[model samples]
Target chain A: MHASDDGPHGHHHEHDHSELSDTALRVRALESVLVEKGYVEPDALDAIIETYETRIGPRNGARVVAKAWADPAFRDGLRRDATAAIASLGFGGRQGEHMVAVENTPEEHNLVVCTLCSCYPWPVLGLPPVWYKSAAYRSRAVIDPRGVLADFGVTLPEGTRLRVWDSTAEIRYLVLPMRPAGTEGWSEEALADLVTRDSMIGTGLARAPGGVAA
Target chain B: MKPLNAMTAALEPVAPLPRCAEEPVFREPWEASAFAMTVALHQRGLFTWSEWAECLGEAIRAAQAEGDPDLGDTYYRHWLLALETMVARKGVAGAALLAQRQAAWDRAAHATPHGQPILLENDPLFTRGA
Candidate 1:
């Protein structure tokens, strides 16, 4: 939040730096102090970062999507009860406790937003992207979802119904993007690799089969 | 279930965090870190949850007065402010240190190009000059 020219003290002079109150700097400072004071462990921070960056993010959701695509039973399970189906795969907690899985079909498109806050299914997805919480994304997604999708380089068929999910804390939403074509016989892992985080958020479509990985 | 928190009523936010909510959704890594620190401090008995709620409520109210729309987008930011409040009050760190660190980061961020991490030349603790 600290732009060079604007701050509480309004010290925006060039080539001068003695103090700053930007969020980044404040967080770093807080972290160092917490660590030095023995309130937090540096190694704990490392592990948390590693988990979010790799082990526990969109990949978890992708696996769920790919499994649903590969197994009719799993798909049915997810449709019947998203919370249970998602939990079966070990991605259940906190922001993800309540999930409603909306699928994209030939006749309909889906998008997710929390105009009130950045409510999302965190277990299946990792941390939300910076843009997701921006006022622009939060506001426009509810008003002009198709336009928002277009900004993400996604364009839908004219007649496809665009369904926007306004996620609340109790009931978060996740888009189950349609499995792309040309992947008939592809393993779940291969299909999972194609599920981009944006697709799950309903901002963009999943990568087409044999297409680029997000 | 824990009793519903009264702070939610005081804040009167359009989209309030669910009472007794275990965790709020995080949209960025820094957001999560900011969140983790607060929880850690509270868990260690640095402050009570009610106190946290009061501090956070006040921060949000202050931001609203400063022309924040009170949209949920600024929720974590309020959380950050509350954290600053607690850390300063509890003597975990001084406000000056935070300000100094923020300045250093601002300079580093300004010098660095987009999409690159901002690196502070000296750790804020060691930099007595600032």
Candidate 2:
């Protein structure tokens, strides 16, 4: 990833990475005022941020996906009721009270979006990337799924159909990508390494064998 | 990869706010702060939920009028706009002061790289409060 390219997990790079979204700066500005007025405690703020930032993130969902790939019974359970299956793994609360997992197969691809707002499954997938929240992505996601995927450098086969799910506050969707080939004997831990944040969002394909997911 | 620790500090706190079953997911640390600030301001009796809704609705309408396509992900932007306008209108803060802070943060954010936090103390222009 580039040091400052705009995408999901766009902030991740191998450098200083001090750049931030405009919303971040605006929030900082507001926080200065709130802190000055004593309306919020600095320590409390840090705890919530740390919870989502480090304690809970993509790894939570990655474990679920890896388990599905390794266990057929678990995959069936996930498809039957993703909420319980995910929560059974101990990753549920806040924005993930309701969860629906969409599987990607050879015949169809699934994409998730919040046409009215950014309704994401935060319990499983960490925070959304900047691009996913952009006006461009929001507008084009429902209207042009193929084009949006292309922008992310993803091209599906000609016969593959695209299914786009619009997220709401009550319900959220996650894309369960197809397990990559040549990973038959790999452990769940190794398989989880191939699952990226974008793959679960349907903007990217799972990493190929010996390929970098990020 | 860029170290996210520098860009966003962590935070925690939950408040009882009006919600029609709101899921309340934040895309970034700042988003959570923004949401908390809105609830905190309301708890302080600064404004009614109705008034906040009106301001947010008006802000969203204004953006749409300005050619924002109404795709919905930028709801927080409108929320920020509403918060800024309401705070200034309510006389809690001067409009000019808010404008100045906005500009200062914009400059600070530009100067900082992708992963660093933007603090008011880091900017010389933000010394008025000290």
Candidate 3:
């Protein structure tokens, strides 16, 4: 596991008064203005904001992963239609929308990056983590995916076919890396240990490193 | 990664704007992802543009009666669900391969802390807002 600066359950500390910067406050204010103009309903807009900020996030994706690793049939369904497949796992929500999960193998590699704007699977994958939506990463991933992967310590062979997916549409693409080797007789929860966020983005592969899913 | 400080932070909320007149209750911001997805599929020749438009309109109406006026706001997910329902209803891509891929992504997300970050530059919300 990545080292937590605060340690496990480190969320108890309240050191930074500035942490509650309310960066979204300005956006909410603007939304209220639009609401007054009758462009959007106050309740609905509030729902959107609260859904993103509080109710949903990346942790949801983790749950889906844990479940899929446990069930064979459900895993098959997710591969067919990620959106509904995920819903079958009981993980769908408002923002997850239409889903397409792509796979990466030893012969072929797949990567997802949004070039135009950040269009992500919110319900299943939850809100996007930070780097997937960065300008530097977006431009560079398309132009030099190999180079960026190198930066991430993921080096692919020249023979490996690199498929870069620009997630610009309503249908979101999630990378499904080949199950790591040396994981026989492992439970789905243990198998889930091997899947990484980068693997889903097509940068890294799921490996059962150190008996932990790293 | 550590959360950004005020000076270096990248995600800041922008002021909201009024909805456009007759903006089609189906044209919610989240729905923009669905619109974009259909456009992508059309570009790839997965289906004709007219077919997508027709289907989207129909889905909007169906979801409306379901008491989901905000259905459009969550378009992409709806598109996924709709696509699943439609694909099953009509049989498009093979289900096994798709499920496998979805499982793979789930594993990947579980392994990586913070998973993938949705950069604002690539986010439809930011671009459409602009």
Candidate 4:
């Protein structure tokens, strides 16, 4: 995906140094300095990484979407105030302090992008995917949402209006994808299984029933 | 899932959006380290997210000015740069100290043998209590 894959940092250089990339080495150095200087605790850093790496991610968002699909009151709450609705589910902190949920219906679809930088909802969706942070997607999504969706193999009907949400550091967005057909009476757990990360990002649709083992 | 359509392939020649991966938020260990360090520092009240975002935005903008391409690979590099700037600006650490540490790491990395973890003590100039 790199125009010039000179190295990991995209700068050409010869280094007899050990296996770490330049940026990696720099981060390690800074981390050691911070830890030594008592600016940050090593264990705290580990805990933060562990949280994002494992504890938090799209599954949290899936549960939110599944609940919205199953519970009308919760959906109403999400519509009125997404931040409180999401936090009510015990998902709020860091990058997701402010939350907004835009629903997808037969007439309209919602997509999220950060034109300035990768301002994603960490509490819900965890860190953004590489594609979501790319300048190509950032610029293109706003200019041509349908084309970008097509790149992800998502095609809406001819008259379906597409709305793109440009996320910022202040507010992060989560697309409440339309519930798939044949999901009637399904448990929230099963419904959540159909909510993929891409679906929440509005690049793809939630999986149809039977797409995953219930 | 369907394959990438022809339209995006034709339009984006220089930098096309990468296909999304299902799992693993970070592509590298250092990325996770840098990301976690920022959050950890914020949790410690080093700086607010607004301050952090401003620094990151400036870093990204500066990188763009210097032709970063913004293809997503060097994103955490910018993140690390912003973290460094924020730490330095917040008086947590100065640029000189950070530079000193970086040089020490360079020496340590070069001195250490292959397949060995690079440690600050590995620096050839290392002196205890100095």
**Among these predicted structures, which one has the highest lDDT?**
4
The collision pairs in model 4 are none
lDDT of 4 by residue, B62-98 (tens): 9989999887777888898998898888888788887
Kindly list the per-residue Cα lDDT of model 1 for residues B1-130, writing each as its tens digit.
Answer: 1123543353343333222212334556667788778756765789875577567767866887798865456778888988999888888787887776666666666665554555564333335433
How does residue A180 of candidate 2 score in lDDT? 95
The alpha-carbon deviation from the true structure for residue B102 of candidate 1, after best TM-score superposition, in angstroms, is 11
Candidate 3 lDDT over B50-74, as tens digits, reads 4554554455456655865331234
| Position B52, candidate 2: lDDT | 71
- Give stretches of model 1 more than 4 Å off: A1-46, A212-214, B1-32, B38-79, B82-130
> Across residues A1-214, which tens digit of lDDT does each residue of candidate 4 receive?
1123365786854433455557777887789878878877888888888888889999999999999999999999998899999999999988887889999999999999988878899899988888887778888899888888877778898899999998887888999999998999999999999999899999989999978311
Tell me the docking grade of candidate 3: incorrect
Computed on C-alpha atoms, the DockQ of candidate 3 is 0.02
The DockQ scores of all candidates, in the order shown, are 0.13, 0.16, 0.02, 0.50
Compared with the true structure, the alpha-carbon lDDT of candidate 3 equals 0.53
Score chain A of model 2 by TM-score against the reference chain A. 0.81
Candidate 3 regions with alpha-carbon error over 4 angstroms: A1-29, A37-50, A66-70, A207-214, B1-130
Evaluated on chain A only, model 3 obtains a TM-score of 0.73
Q: Using Cα atoms with residue i matched to residue i, what is each candidate's TM-score against the true structure?
A: 0.62, 0.62, 0.50, 0.88
Assess the local accuracy of residue A23 in candidate 4 as a C-alpha lDDT between 0 and 100: 79
User: Between candidates 3 and 4, which one is better according to TM-score?
Assistant: 4
- Residue B1 error, candidate 3, Å: 18
Which ten-residue region of model 4 chain A has the weakest summed lDDT?
A1-10
Q: Candidate 1 on A97-185: residue-level lDDT in tens?
A: 77989999989988998665466677898767656765566777877776566555567888999988887757888899988878889
